[model samples]
Target: MLSTAAVSWKEPNVECSIDIGLCPNIKYKHKTAQRRLTLFEDFVAFGGVCVSWRLVMAALKKDFNMLPRVPWLMLAEKDDGSNLRDFYCPMKCKNIYRSMLPKASGKRFFSSQGWLLTIAADHEVNLLHPLSRVQILLPNLTTFSNLEEMATHCTDKLYHNFIQKAVLSSSPSTTSDYAIMVIHGAISKLAFYRRGDNAWTTIETWLSAYSDVIYHEGRFYAIDCWGRIVVCDVNGSCPTRGQIMPVMPNEFTHSLEKLYLVESLGKLLIVLRQGVTTRDDYTHGTTRLRVFELNWEEVQSLGNRALFLGFNSSFSVEASNEIKANCIYFTDDCFEAYYSASFADEGAPNYHPEGGGKDMGIFNLSDGSIEPHFRGRSFDPLSPPMWVTPSF
Candidate 1:
């Protein structure tokens, strides 16, 4: 269905295995001045150096509402294994469907390009397409050196639970030469695996721990707990780390805040979540929000783009009349201690006691105001909610 070529880059004394075979020469059928459409067109050409044309067309067609309906978030009831529901806030419509894979009891760690990265009970990793019911099993968790030792000591489950996030280099729907990168281990080590790799290659970094990662501009950029950014070359024999970006100034005192990295309008952004801890249960309630654009190692304000954050994934969509600019729609799952404890049930509904109020809400960047998005409905703290962009 597609053609391929072998592309190799050489750096003196270093081994590199970068694959650019899937990178297609994209052509536009029509020209338009619309900024969103132009941006999407450029993203297809330059975002990921190895993205296929089929993947680009599929993503753009679905995202731009060219299909019957634009994709919306799907919330899976944790306890119910038989059905899944789609929540469309813009259309105020809800559609229920049978579970695509009822036997997948793994906790979802990341979502990107219409794929969900999950870890099963036996510690196996998979990229699942919920609508198509397609699953790609990646290198098992036991393939990691440290995790293997933990498995030998009967503590693999405890260590495997540390993997909180993952991202795909390219959508598997169109390319078989994609890679999966994940942040795992007790101290948050970075590792990546390609399609044919027998094991994941870990990238060595000086940072103590990493918070989030995103693939942008032909490389992987990750943020540490202390707000430091590290870039990685994923295709190398042993993925090497590039220079660290400057850290942003701290404005909040709470140590429980969450950090996320998202690509918006061809630029990279770092979002910081500020919250207050309840004295009794220690659950977090968002108090303020801050967004900064990473411009050549400096941080600036994010202009005109609204961000969406959740445990499954973080991404940016254009601001319209319905979705205001300079705001964040966040879910309840912040990967807190209480929620992690419920992984045994694969983050089933009501695994932990409900907190003070629903954690899903919208935060305004200009005035620091918080408002509930789903009124009067409290979500399970452990299960939280995931923002799913449908693809079929």
Candidate 2:
């Protein structure tokens, strides 16, 4: 009661407007002293809190110096409702954060290791690192070989589903001395673009459909649908015919088994997954899996390492305490999704008219149980959810 007479009349909002958080110089000094290896997304989330955090974000935007963080479960683009694409930062946040990515609008996405490859409606191809927003333009889809053979298909339809996968010899951020390889066309014909090339140079493996490609050691190794590997070098005026490795037999019979070629702990592996396409609803389900080395030795344990495979580039990670060890994390790589997005007039089979996302989960080898990775609406046909390893 006595405070009314003694207290001064001042506006709290106006008087307390100055930043109470750390000063810019102090913030930066602490950052330097701690030397914390911060995640790109984590810094973004921290920016919304106060003025000093925003300064940190500004510093990050100007100079991004961090390695790839834990794999983020980037969900599919939403329906016509919003531009916000949701992502689940697995080991970092364990929560969903929505981001507006207009650059990816209406474009097909393929992963080149940690980076993303986007194909525009005009057939313009671009390699984009989403976190860093650094982009490199490659020759368009029309530049690929055998375009004359696909005269019947519309340009939109052909370019949308043409690229099966893309792999980078080295990250474009670190150095310019690198090469890019893409498995494109209906038959998965392999092509490469190097540091000094104007157009793509095809490696005439003359094999069946290729599923995956990886750059290991000093050469590029590409595996086809029938489990045959062709090793080719990115040297010479034109690539000599690819040297064929002996075909590894797929004990599990599916049209195109052994989709992922992953090199973990200096050991190359063939992950065999058998899934049947139910044309009724396009609900593809996998029941059996075999992850084995190229020498036909079975992998019984992964120790502290985890493997991630999907529509994006397949890679392995050393697990932290927050993440599960010896678990295989997978995402939606349903080939039917592309046809559904591109082949509207071509009488493509409808995928679950119910309008829901595809199947993605983690399989524990020790327990043989499956668990959901994310519970987001990732049903966009043109651009589905994929595993994105964040890098700057």
Which is the leading candidate under lDDT?
2
Model 2 stretches with alpha carbons more than 4 Å out: 1-41, 47-68, 80-83, 236-240, 250-258, 279-282, 341-349, 353-356
TM-score of 1: 0.71
Against the reference, the lDDT scores of all candidates come to 0.59, 0.68
**Tens-digit lDDT track of model 2 for 351-372:** 5543224667888878777787
Give the local distance difference test score of model 2.
0.68
Clashes of each: 0, 0
* Per-residue C-alpha lDDT of model 1 across residues 141-221, encoded as one tens digit per residue: 778756553543345454334566778887787789788778887777788888898887778787868878888877888
Worst 10 residues of 2 by lDDT: 1-10
Cα RMSD (angstroms) for every candidate in the order listed: 12.6, 8.4
**Poorest lDDT segment (10 consecutive residues) of candidate 1:** 1-10
On TM-score, the candidate that comes out on top is 2
Error of 1 at 270 (Å): 1.2
